[model samples]
Every structure is written in C-alpha cells, then in structure tokens.
Target: MSHHATPVPRHRAPAQPTTDYDVIIIGAGSAGLSAALALGRCLRRVLVCDGGPPRNAPSPGVQSFFTRDGIKPAELLRVGLAQLEPYETVEVRRAQVQRVKPAGRTFTVEAEGKSGRTFTATARKLLLATGVEDELPPVPGMRDLWGRGVLHCPYCHGWEVRNQPLAVYGQGKIVTGMALLVSRWAPDLVVCTDGPGHLSDNARRRLRQQKIKVNEEPISHLEGTAGGQLRNIVFQSGEKLARHALFVHPHQHQRSTLAEQLGCRLTSKGAVWINKHSQTSISGLYAAGDTTSGPQKALLAAAEGMEAAIAIHETLTREECPK
Candidate 1:
C-alpha cells in the first residue's frame, strides 16, 4: 500500500452537539487505533481524533513490533487507520484537541482543525493515548540526528549499530546505567557527561569494569554527515571523538495536557498513572501507550489499548445490565 494514501478521510462537517459516542479517544496512534478496533468490534461508538504525527515520526521505522518490524512509522499508522474502515461505528477526525472538560459523568472535548475551524465532541468515557515528547539536549546537531544516529532506545536501534563505535550521553548514575546497558550491543562504548558527570566512586568503578571510557569534557557540538548520521563528538577543547552513534536518555513530558486538565493523577515522571485495567485515577478516564508509565514500545502500547478497551467495555456493560 502507498504510504501517501490518506489514513483517515477528512470530515468537513462539524461534530453533532450530542453525547452519542461511547468513547472519545484523543490519539490515533497504535494505542488509540487498537482500542477503537476492540470497541468497534464490540459494537460501541468510538471517535478517534488524529492529533497529527506521533512522537516516533522522526524515526525511520518502528522496531521490535512483531510482524510489522522495520515498517515506517507513518506506514504503520496508515495500516492501522485503514483497518478501522470496516467498522462504521468508529470515526476518526484529524484535529488537535485543545481542552477536555468534565460534565459530571460525561466529558466534553474541544479541538481545532487545520482549517482553523473548532469543534466540540462529547462522550461517556475518554481515553488518552497521547504520547510523550522527548526533550533532546541543547547541543547542536542533536535534533537533526534524532532517531538516526542519536537514538534513545537500545532495543530499538542497537542491533543496527551493534559492534560499532558508540557513545552514551548523560551524567551521574543515569549515564552510568545507560552506558552499561548499551555496552551489550557495542563493546566499544564511551560515556560523554558533557562536563561534571557527578558519578559516585562505585559508578565509575562499574563503568571502568565494563571498559567504558568516561569523558567529562563539555561538548562544543556534535558533527554529523550530510545525510544526518552522527560523525563525531566535538569537545570544547577542540578535540573530536569519532562515533557512529550516540545514545541518550532525554527528559520527557506529556505531549498533551488533557490528563492534567481532567485532574488525572500523574507519576513523578509525568506519565499518567493508571490501574491494572488502564483506567486513570479519575473514574471512566482511561490512558494507555506512552501516556502511562512503563517501557514505551509500539507493541506494548497496542496491548495496553486492547486491555483498556476490554475494561471499558465491561464497565459499560455493567452499567447497562445493572446487576
């Protein structure tokens, strides 16, 4: 299938001012689409709002996803959206959700389209699959090489760069941990603290035991090839360390504030906290994928979405049956 094919058809008309949808999914990534598939199969009305490109858009392809491994990120989503077409009860809108308001049991969502048109949608339950945003280092050339030479997840990009010269960017115990983890893929690894690694004696010993070199010099900037692949790490002292790839554990924050807007509890890491059923602290509000805590992977996010849908369906069933 052509990757350029329209994932979801555009709806020119405004959403009706009624709470007709059983669930309002705020994201159209793997998680949201998986939930829609489950809910749609259950004969429930679901509205999935496509909030534009996902966090992994910069990546060339999705890794470690069973069967679909190495598929382009956009192509994976296009396949997901295409699969939902058979379910008439499921509708997808390409809009940016701005705010979510709670009305007793139901919830009201306000979103704006690309054409500057605004619309309101209401549903009995809300699912937030909105992912997180990676805050890359301020060093030059970092963003340009993101998902290419500057990768964060080892499992996702390690094999491709295995046995190649690599570097882990961070400081203190975090960098220590990352260096050790990344060493499994590349024996030739170094830790670039960018000045003052803040490492404990034990941490340094561990890294030394692993034969990982530590560089405390502040990085002047990263040098990359014309194709955006990392070439070397240039230090302030005018020294350059040749490296094929650099791994980092960048800080992250929620991509959307809808969870906070609806008063959902959040972990210290800023991910939406959820119960076993994928329901958030607030009743009837569900969250899955990178929005919630734990390992962030496409396959795992899809599983979480399916679990959340099953729970939501059971909850709705209980309400209707009234045992």
Candidate 2:
C-alpha cells in the first residue's frame, strides 16, 4: 500500500473535519499513547481515541514494568496525558471506536457512546492500539475479582501472592504446564480440572513429581471471602479446598473488532498481523501493543509504539515531500 500523505494543517486538528485526518489512532493504552506521544512530538496533527479500557486494568499495580513498576494503571495514563501536552500536536479523546473504513486516499472512522462520534480523517494513515480481553472460566466469583485475588498473569501478580496457598484451575494440559510454572512461586498449590480430563499421563507425572495435586473432580463453583480474595473452592461433590489465591491461564480474544471490520489480516493468535516496522497489511495503517502478536508486556508494547511512530514519521514525510 502507498504511504499515507501528511494531513494538511497538521496542527491541533479542528473539532471535526469534512474530508479526512492526517492520522487517527484508535487506542489510548500504553502502545497507542506512546505512539501518539511520538507523533505529537513530530508535529503530525494526531488524534487518539481510546475507550480507556486496557487488559491490565484489573491489577492494582503493574510489575516488571521498568521504572514505572508498582503503579496503578490509571495513574500511568494520567502521566501520559500530562506529557503529551508539551507537543501541542496530539489530541486524545475518550471514545469506543466502532468501525474503520478506508476510502480512496482517506479513511472514515465511527466511534460510539457519550464518547461516540463520526468523523473523516483526510490524512494518510491509521494506528490501532486496541488491546485484548481475557476469557475466564464460568466460576461464580472469578470475573468480579479478576485483577484481585483471581489473577491471570503470574509475572504481574505472582510476587504479591507468593508463598500463599494457591489454586490452579484449568481445562486440559495447558493448565498442567501452567501449574508447573506457578509452583515455582508458591510451593503449596492445587491443580484441578472442573471437567473430565485435560492433562495427559506424561504431563500428570511431571505435576506429581513437583508435588502439585492434580484433581479431576468436576468443579461445582468457587467461594470467596469478603475482600473478594479467593478462599475455599467448592467442587461438585460438596468437597472444599482451602486457597488464598486462584491462578488461571486466560483464554484471550482480540478486543479490536474494528480491525476485522477494516480487513486487517489477523494472525492465528487473533492479533493483528504487522511487519517489523509495525505496518499492517493495508498500506498507511499500523498497529502496536497487545493488538500485535508477540509478547504481551506493557514495556514491550511501549517500545513497539515508539518504533511504529518513527515509521509513521518517515513514511508521512517521504510521501508529503514535493517530487
């Protein structure tokens, strides 16, 4: 695809444009925000629309995140907004993007909610930073207590819940592997599949060697304490097990329905496909963060965003320069 031409008067954009934008970014999370920051610095007349919902929202503190470790997710966004102010070239809007369509050399974007509006970006490029959503088991209290006691990412919440009695719930062998890794942090662990069978025999032996109990009991439901901390898990046979925390392997789904709607190719992992430069299949379009396949770390996403922003700068500049 041809590189996007820079938007005309790429300053702080007007309220709404009749033609198109120079660039419209569709997420405001770490990757999207980082990309916006770079573009704003380049003076690219950029607008970022984020629903403000990120996969990491459930956890109180983000660990292994370099200098910003142990900070609330919302607090990071606050800092991003403040830093972005210096550029005077980026505008961040809180909106849930519904759809995106490329027409000729421009694109039309429709966003929804009190945060909803329709506008055309006359500019030549697009960036998607929308993240993913985790699919948790149908336990009574799991979803409500997601980022709390019932956690998905071990690296993020493992240290906090380390050394505590933990319950590992999973379906098949995938859970078995996770149980082995989790046992490293918490010695006392219980591995169970609510249904008939998932883990194979060889997998079972490794789990047993590690002293992690593998139970094949059908789970009736989960029981939690007042603070939403996972307490005792109840099995179908009225059996109960004591646990302070429940670790799970979240089945994830891409939250960017807009990507599919826009014909962006999706990989097997459900992430938007991109080149090393973060450029997607459609020319002039780019993606970063969880939306792109690879690692799901916040720090990594930020780096990818910065890289994509640089590419955006080069591409736009090259396209706009007079021949």
Name the lDDT of candidate 1. 0.92
Question: lDDT, candidate 2, residue 121?
Answer: 44
Model 1: pairs clashing at backbone N, Cα or C within 3 Å: none
lDDT of 2 by residue, 20-78 (tens): 45788888888988998889888888888878667887778777888998989888878
Give one digit per residue, the lDDT tens place, for model 1 in 29-63: 99999999999999999999999999999898899
- Residue 258 C-alpha lDDT in model 1: 86
Candidate 1: regions farther than 4 A off: 1-18
User: Cα RMSD (Å) per model?
Assistant: 10.5, 6.9
Minimal lDDT window, size 10, model 1: 9-18
Candidate lDDT scores, in order, read: 0.92, 0.82
After TM-score superposition, the amount by which residue 29's alpha carbon in candidate 1 deviates from its true location, in angstroms, is 1.0
How many residue pairs clash in model 2? 8
Q: Each prediction's TM-score against the native? A: 0.93, 0.90
